[model samples]
Target: MDCREAREKLLLATSDDLPSAEASELRSHLTSCAACRGEEARLADVFGRLATMKRDRMPESVRAGYWEGLSARLREEGLVRSPGGARSVARPARGISARLAGATVAAAVLVGAFLVGWFAGLFTQQEKGTEPPRAVRPDTPPPAPRADEGREREPIESAPATGWTSDFALGNGPADRGEGVYAEFVLGPEAAGENPVEYGIDEALPQDPWVASIDF
Candidate 1:
């Protein structure tokens, strides 16, 4: 047998479970291969040491009591396989349930603490009232005007009556009447005729009777 096959059979051999043919093959390989023999010897020594160290030498009475207790426990847990199996029951795994329970409790506590801290942070942020800062844009050139630039405004023929007006001769002046036509009218002594009227007369009838006038 090759070294790999021999090593596999060697493990089964240590368990006293190797078939007779395989056992013989492994023994034959060990006789010719010094390296395989040395490996087997090392494994055997390690297994022997472990076996010697791990087992606690118990008195016959104590051993019997332990077996009885294990059998009763197995019966209670509904794990007793057969009537004869109780005498040679496997040892219960060491502290597995206690370890698992402790780990579960620790994990729960850690999760609860993390959740509390997370919510506390949220509450703190709410209390402080944090808001994202407004973004500042970089300076850029002003936009150009649309193509239909000066066409928006239609020129007014005259100033608004209630606002202000400008005569052809006078530059810019306030309107005489609050609401009146913005046409030019002759207003000198000659234009007023022989019975000339002053500018601020309250009842100054126009010399031209048909001309449009204001009451005030």
Candidate 2:
């Protein structure tokens, strides 16, 4: 074998894990090559030290307990994937729904209370910008209408009526009219006599001229 092949086998041979064929080839190369022999010796020394050295190890009891705890934990996690196992977990969802319902009820009550209070205030308060109507009092039966109150009172007739009277009643009668059903002459006897008492030019005037002159 070449030095490279010899070196590869030598590494496996140091741990005594080389196949018999490779070992025989490595031995043949070592016999012929000084370099291969030196490498073999160095590798053998390292593995010898590794094999002989003592190391700290866990006790069988500790190892078994650790494995048991790990297995138990894994089993629990696997079981949690099942529906029945999922039910075992605590849920905040139901509690949240209950709280929401309670909150809604509380809100409704608050609204109702506010409305009632508002309506009560409206009804109890007096109206704005206008006066409240006066309350009607119960009628008292008008002093039982006295016995004499219903009778028609007789009014004494006035001689001259209250408002307006005819012109005859005011002493203004027609020229030919008489008073009190009797024909009384309203005109006086002729003012001038046949003989003149006090002579004036009006006495010389005829009756027709006098009438005409007085008119004109």
Candidate 3:
């Protein structure tokens, strides 16, 4: 047998997996090849040392601590009840952080909607070729009046003096003639702080007379 075959059988023999017939062939090859004999001796020494070494075991307190921590975590999560209590109280469906996050998202949405509406209105105005109304400032001056505004108004005229006359019940004009109708006239005060008591009449009527004299 070759040294390669002998080495394979040597590893199996160390684990007690090789058959008796293969073990005999491996031993004959090791005796003939010096290198195979040294390799078999090295494997025997490694296996012997491993077999003599002691195995370590996990501590009881470590397992107990792990189970206690898991039970505490389950209790905090409301998945398990306390050992002292007969029943468990359910936690709120929404936590403080969840409610706060909802409020923040709502506020952000409102602000975003307001901004979008404002921008849309601005863009629409621009598309329509219309300008937005500007705010009136306190310092801005009022519009000036037109130049012909004053001249457009007409002057008020006084009433005619004949409008104050009243017809008389006696003779039409004078005692000498009874053809024309007699009329009374009203006059204003000639000076300040003086009562107007002067009276006059005309004997002959004219078409348009400025003055006339008569006796009562």
Question: Per-candidate TM vs. native?
Answer: 0.26, 0.25, 0.25
**Model 1 stretches with alpha carbons more than 4 Å out:** 54-216
For model 3, name the residue pairs that clash: none
Candidate 3, poorest ten consecutive residues by summed lDDT: 207-216
Error of 1 at 215 (Å): 99
Q: Tens digit of lDDT per residue, candidate 3, span 1-216?
A: 764456446656766777999888877777777765655665565445333322222233222343354345446655446876643322223332233332222111221122222232423443354532322323212223433223211111222432221111111122132222222211222233443221212111111111111000
What local distance difference test score does each model get?
A: 0.33, 0.30, 0.34
Residue 34 displacement in candidate 3 (angstroms): 1.1
lDDT of 2 by residue, 4-114 (tens): 456546645765678998888788878877755765665454444332222222233322333233234334544222234532222223333233332222212222122
Greater lDDT among 1 and 2 belongs to: 1
lDDT of 2: 0.30
Which portions of model 3 show Cα errors greater than 4 Å?
57-216
Give the 10-residue window scoring lowest on summed lDDT in candidate 2. 179-188
